[model samples]
Each structure stands twice: as structure tokens, then as C-alpha cells.
Target chain A: MINKATEVFVSRGYDGTSMDTVARELGITKSAIYHHVKSKEELLHLAINRGISALDSAVEDERQRTGLTALERLRAAVHASVVILIEYHHSVTLLLRVRGNSDVEREALEQRRKIDDKIRALVAEAIGEGGLRSDFTPGLITRLLFGMVNSITEWYRPSYPVDPEAIADAVTSMAFNGLEA
Target chain B: MINKATEVFVSRGYDGTSMDTVARELGITKSAIYHHVKSKEELLHLAINRGISALDSAVEDERQRTGLTALERLRAAVHASVVILIEYHHSVTLLLRVRGNSDVEREALEQRRKIDDKIRALVAEAIGEGGLRSDFTPGLITRLLFGMVNSITEWYRPSYPVDPEAIADAVTSMAFNGLEA
Candidate 1:
């Protein structure tokens, strides 16, 4: 039920979604929803937490892997991120849509920043190790690489047959080699 | 007055904005706004078109610059895009928020695709000329490049001391080198 409500909230946006609409989608009373979560904000928070945990888990997994070069580890991290994002499309969509206006939204934003910092650290390590090319500033490279990765959320639909690994491969390759001949 | 309304619309979102609120901020009659535009949608259309025209004009200018390599032209296109996006931040904010629900939105989306095609062609030409790396798929690389370029819209503020040209140079360099050491 929370998942269904999350889809509605993602499509309608938080400000556009309402308790009554969530109830309508679930064919349950508003009181029934209240039984589970305190309010729509709570649902948004729950959904964001689920998505954040998936990303954090992916990063943690990559960190635990041994004997990999920095570039190899970064590739694994990208793969895991793409898979997790595709797997939890609805919840992650809500997470991406959030603007830090309310308390819950601000908390989610802070959590996201921490997660971003972890990912950025991984990229920074690779840069420091000379596994990637030099000349580009680390901060700019991090943002561009993540921006490329994050753009998957805008166009990817789970129903599409494109494998998550394939998407990650294409993204990783593009990040390394630009479109010049 | 329109600037005040744009600030509210950008911050609060289009659906969340109301004419009465705009009037309240300006201390004017709601009827006064109707004299300027027929409806909120008209105002939205106007705002988005302003940004769209700027992008369109930039692309045209780059296309017209003779004797430059495709790579050089692409660099100019990117620089102009960031500057124009910063100049019309509120309009671009609204433009990015569009979800493609209406006819105007659909048209805007088509125009966006057209701009994308123009950039992709330049990327393709650069690739063919051996100016860009060719290890990645052209389609994916084009999207990633644009993703990194367009993501600037999310964080750039005109009030920030950072020059858009500096950002453009950073993005162009980072897109080529990546974050690996």
C-alpha cells in the first residue's frame, strides 16, 4: 500500500498529491492510511529512506570488494547504483523529486548530501591514485560523472528491456571516452 | 510585477502558484494580472519561451560561426547555454519542471529534442574528425554530455560569484578527463 501511494506521490509530486488521492488509489479509507503512516510527509520520508538505503548499501558493497583498481571499483559502484536505482524506481523517483522545504524534506536532503559525499570520496580517491586522467578538476569531474549517472533516472523505465548492467556499461564507457572520433 | 510573480512561481512551482498570491505579493488586484495575460498557463508559456529562445539563439550563433572546428563550436554552444540559463534562471527553472502533460509542453519537448539533435550532430562530427574519443557509443555520450551541461540549471544562481564561463570550461574539461586518477 505504501508502495502504491509512493507511485501516486511521485507522479503527482508531493505538493500536488493528497491523502484522499492516496486513499482512492488504494481503495482504502483515509483512516486506514493514518493507521500506517502519520501523514503524506511521513510517506515521502519513508520512500526516500528506502531509496537512500539502497544506494548506501551499493556503495558499502563496492567498498568491501578487494584487489580492484580505483577505476574498477568505480565501475562496480556505477553498476550497483544503476541496478539499485532501476530496481526501486518509484521510491527513488520520490527521493529525486524532493525539494528541501519541509522538515522531512530537509532531513532527506541532508542524508542525500552525505551519500553524495561518500560517492564523491570514492571518485576523489580514484583521481588521487592517478587511475583516471589528470587535467580536469576533481570537483567538476565528480559533478559531471554523477550528473551523467543521475540522468538515467530521468529516462529509464523498468518496463524497458534494457539491462541495468548494459546501461551501466554504456554510461561508464561514455564517462571515460567522450563522443569525439 | 511579472518578475515578482516569476520568483513565486519558480520557488512554489506552477501548480502551487495562484494569481491571488501573485496579486497579494504585489498589492494589486487579481484583475490587473488578467490584463497582462489571459491565464496562468499563458504566463508559464511566456516564461519558458523566454529561456527557449535564448538557447535557440545560442545554437544558431554557434552554427553560423564559420572556420571553427565542431569541437570549438560545441564549446561555444555550451558556454552560451550556461550563460543564458543563468540569465533567465526562473524561466529555466519552470522549463525544467515541465512534465510534458499538455500540447504546449509537448511542443516544448519537441523543441528540446531539436536542440539535442543539433548538439548530437556536432558531437558526431567531432567524433568523425578524430577530435573526440570514440570508445563510447555516440548516442550515450551525447546524452551524458548534455546531462552534465544541463545539470548546471539545477545549482547556478546569478548572484553567485562563479562565472558561467569558468563553469563551462570546467565541464568541458571534466567531460573529457573524468574523475579517475
Candidate 2:
């Protein structure tokens, strides 16, 4: 049901979507939806949480927690983020489009910031150990790295032949080695 | 007036904004706004075009046009894009958030795609001249590069101490040299 709600929210703007629309799309009564979810806001919260939990788990994955080094863990996190984003494309798309008009959205934004802080910490650790460049601030590096990865949500289509692993590889290569020949 | 509208759109969202709100914010009569723009859609068009024109001018700047290798031009475009995005942060924020729900929005999206294609061509040319890595497709590279650059619209604030030149330098360095120590 939350998946269905996510699809509606992704296709229709969050403000434009309603419980009635979700119910109509699901071929269920509004009362049925209300029985499970109290409001459209609740549904949106659940939908966004799907993407957030995926990202949080990716950063806290066993590999990231016990990696070869900070750089390795950072790379793993980046790769995992791209993969998870692709895996939960619809929900993440909805999450990314959020503009914090409501308390639920504010909470989601806060959660996203926590994830960003974790990635930034990994970047700082990598720079500390001389695994990554230290000239740019870790905060800037984190934003750019995630910016590149997060862009997948804007243009990626399931119809495309590209897969998550391929994207992860490209992001890792371009971010670490750059485009210089 | 378009700038004011852009500000309102950036804060309240395009759909949530109305000419009445813009007029209220600007301390102008609705008739005065109607004298210039036919409707809210027209205002949105003008606002988005402001950002689009800046980007187009950056790509067509004399520096981008003459006496540079493909790599140099690509770097120049990257730098100019970041600068322009910061310079026109509000309008570009609205432009980036547009989902093409209206005719004006569709036109804006089409213009954005034209700029994207131009950048992609630069990436291809750079690869042809051995200035960039060819392992990743030009399309992928362009998306990632702009994704990183375009993200400025989401977080950049004029109150922040960061300057456009510094951002441009960081983007060029990280994009060309990458993060490897």
C-alpha cells in the first residue's frame, strides 16, 4: 500500500496527492486506507522512510563498519548509496523531491542530514589517513560526492540497460580517479 | 518582478505560489503584474528563462568560444555553470524543481535539455581529444558532472561565506584531478 502511495506521490506532486487519490488508484475504499494509515501525511512519511532506512542501512552496513580503511568504507558507502537509490528509485525520488512543507518532511530532512554527517565523517577520516585529497574541506567533498550519486534519481530509468553495479563502478571511478586520461 | 516571483516560488513552491501572493510580497497591484505578465504561468516562464539565459550566455561566452582545447572549454563551462547557478540561485532552484506539469514548465524543461546536450557535446569532444576518461559514456559523465554542479541550487546560500570562484576551482579540481591523494 505504501508502495502504491509512493508511486502516486512520485507521479503526482506530494501536495497534489491525497488519501482519496491513493485509495482510488488502489481500487480500495478510503476507509480501508484510513484503517492502515491515518492520513496522507502518514503515508508520505512511510514512503520517505523506506528510502531513508535504505540509505541509513547502507552507511551502517557491515562492510562500512569493518572496512579495510576509511577510504574503502567511503567508497563502499558511495557505491551502496547508488545501488540502494536505484533499488528504491520511486521512494527515493519522492524523498528527494521533498521541500519540507510539513512536520513529516522536516523529520525526513533531519534524517537525511544525519546520513550526510555520517558520510562527511567518513570523508574526514579518509583525508586524515591520506587516502583522499585534503585540500577541499570534508563537507564540500561529501556534498559533491553525494551530489553526483544522488543525481541518479533524476535521470535513471529502469528501461535503460545500465544497472546499479555499473553506475556504482562509474561513480567510484570518476570520483576517485577523475576523468584525466 | 520576476525575481520576486522566483523568490516566492523557491520558498513556497511553484504550485503554491500565485500572482496574488507575488503581488502581495512586492507591494504591487495585481493589475500591475497582469500588465507585464499574462498569468502566473507567464511569470514562471520569465523567471525560469532568466536562469536559462544566464546558462546559455555562459556556454556562449567568448572564452568558451575561442582559443581553448575541448578540455579547457569543458572546464570553463563547468566553472561558469557553477557561478551562474550561484548568481541566479533562486530562479535556478525553481527551474531545477520544475516537474513539467504545465506548458510553461515543459518549455523550460526543453530549454534545460538543450543546455544539457551542449554540455554533453563538450564532454564528447574532450574525450575525442583524450582530455577525459572514456571508460564512462559521455552521457553518464555529463549527468554526473552537472549533477554535482547543479546541486548548488539546493544548498548554497548567499549568507554562506563561500564564493563562486572558490566553488568553481573546487569543482574543476575535484572533477579533473579527483579525490585520490
Candidate 3:
């Protein structure tokens, strides 16, 4: 149901989507949707949280990968982030469009900032370990890194021959090694 | 007038923004707005085109930059592109949010695709010159590159000490040399 809502929200702007639309799309009565969710905002909260929780779990997983160095963890986390973006593509799309107009969106934006801080911390650690470049601030690097990673959601189509792992590899490679020969 | 419209459009989603809102925000009457523009979509067309024209000029400028290698031209173009994003920040923000819901929006999106094609062609030519790594396709590289560049609108504040030049340098540096130590 959340996935269906996300699809509706992504296809139609979030402001343009309604509980009635979701209900009709689901072939259920409006009361049936109201039984599970009081408002469209509730459905948005649930759908957005689906993507947020996946990203949170990825960050937590990277944080606890005991054997890996900061740089390794950062790379793995970028890969994981890309995979999660693909898996939760529509939700992430909706998340990116959020401008904090509502309390729910504001809360989601705060959670997103927390995740960014975590990624930036790992980037700082990698620089401290003398693996990643020290010249660029971790904030800038993390922003650009995820800028590239987050872009995957914009252009990727499921029918394409490129798998998530392949795209992830391309992202990590170009991100670390760059385009220069 | 376009600037004020862009400001309103950026703060309020295009679907939510009306000529009355722009007129109100600009301290003008609805008749005054209609005197200059027929509808809200016309304002969107003007605002979005401001960004598209700036980017088009940047690409055209790079294309004419003589006595430079393909790699150098690509780098310079990235710098100019970043600068335009800052100069036309609100318009670019609105442009990024466009999902081709209207005829004007679809036209804007098509123009945006042409710009992307221009940049991707430069990436390909750079690779052909043996300066860029050929492992990744130009389409992938160009998308990631603009993804990093386009992200500026999300967090950039003019109050920050970081100027557009500094941001552009950081972008091109990480883009070309990457973050590896």
C-alpha cells in the first residue's frame, strides 16, 4: 500500500495526490484506506519512512563493519546507498522533492541531515587516516559523493541492462578514481 | 519580475503557485501581472528559460574556447555551469523540479535534455582525446557530473563565505582529480 502510494506521489506531485486517488488506484473504498491511514499525510509519512529506514540501516551497517577501514566502509556505504536508492527509488524521489513545508517533511529532512552527518563523519575519518584527500572538507566531499550516488535515482530504469551492482561499481570507481586518465 | 516569480515558484511548488501569488509577492495587482503575462505557465516558461539560456550560453562558450584540449574545455565548462547555477539559482531550482506536466514544462525538459547531450558529447570527445578514462560511458559520467553541479541549489546560501568560484573549483577538482590521497 505504501509502495502504491509512493508510485502515485511520484507520478503525480505529492501535493496533487490524495487519499481518494490512492484508494481508487488500489481498488479499495475510501473507508478502507481511512481504516489504515487517517490522511494522505499519514501515507506520505509511512512511504517516506520506508526509504529513510533503509538508508538508516545502511548507515548503521557501515558503522558496524568492524574489519573495514574508514575508507573501505565509506566505499561500501556508497555502494549500499546506491542499492537502497534503486530499491526504494520512488520513495527517494519523493524524499528529494521535500521542502519541509509540512511537519512530516521537516522531520524527514532532519533525519536525512543526520544520515548526511554520519556519511560526512566517515569521510572525515577516511581523510584523517590518510586514505582520502585532506584538501577538500568532509562536508563538501560527502555532499558531492552522495550527489553522484543520489543521481542514480534520476536516470536509472529497471529495464536497462545495467544492474545495481554495476552502477554502484561505476559510481564508486568514478567517485574515487575520477574521469581523468 | 521573472526573478520575483522564480522566488515565489521556488518557495511554492509550481502547481501551487499562481499569478496572483506572484503578483501578491511582488506587490502588484493581478491585472498588472496579466498585463505582462497571459498565465502562470508563461511565468514558469520565462523563469525556466532564464536558466536554460544561461546553461546554453555556458556550453556554447566552452565550445568556442580555442587553444584548449578537450579535457580543459570540459573542466572550464563545468566551472561555468556551476557559476550559472549560482547566478540563476532560483530558476535552476525550479528547472530541476520540473517533471514535464505541462506543455511549457515538457518544452523546458526537452531543452534541458539537449544541454545534457551537449555536455555528454564533450565528455565523449575528451575520452576520445585519451584524457578521460574510457571505462565508464560518457552518459554515466555526464549525469554524475551534473548531479554534483546541480546539487548546489539545495544547500548554497549567498551568505556563506564560499563564493561560486571556490565551489566551482572544489567541484572540478573532485571531478577531475577525485578525492583520493
Per-candidate iRMSD: 2.9, 0.8, 0.9
The residue-level lDDT of candidate 1 at B22 comes to 76
TM-score of each: 0.84, 0.94, 0.93
**Model 3 TM-score (2 dp):** 0.93
Which candidate has the highest lDDT of all? 3
Per-residue alpha-carbon lDDT of model 2 for A23-118, expressed as tens digits? 899899999988998888998999999989998998888235763899899888888899999989999998888778899999998999899989
lDDT of each candidate versus the true structure: 0.75, 0.87, 0.88
Residues B48-135 of candidate 2: C-alpha lDDT, one tens digit per residue: 9899899888986723577788888988888988989999999888889888889999998898998888889999999999989888
Q: Sort the predicted structures by DockQ, highest score first.
A: 2, 3, 1
Top candidate when judged by DockQ against the true structure: 2
Clashing pairs in 3: none
Tell me the DockQ of each model, to 2 decimals. Answer: 0.45, 0.79, 0.73
Candidate 1: residue pairs that collide? A126-B181, A127-B181, A130-B181, A131-B181, A132-B180, A132-B181, A180-B127, A180-B132, A181-B127
Tell me the tens digit of each residue's lDDT in model 3 across B96-162: 9898889999999999999898889989999999999998889888988998899888888788567
- In candidate 1, position A85 carries an lDDT of 81
Per-residue alpha-carbon lDDT of model 1 for B60-83, expressed as tens digits? 899679999888887778777777
lDDT tens per residue, model 3, A52-158: 89999998898779988899999888888988999899999889878898999999999999999899999999999998988778987888888877877778778
TM-score-superior candidate, 1 or 2? 2
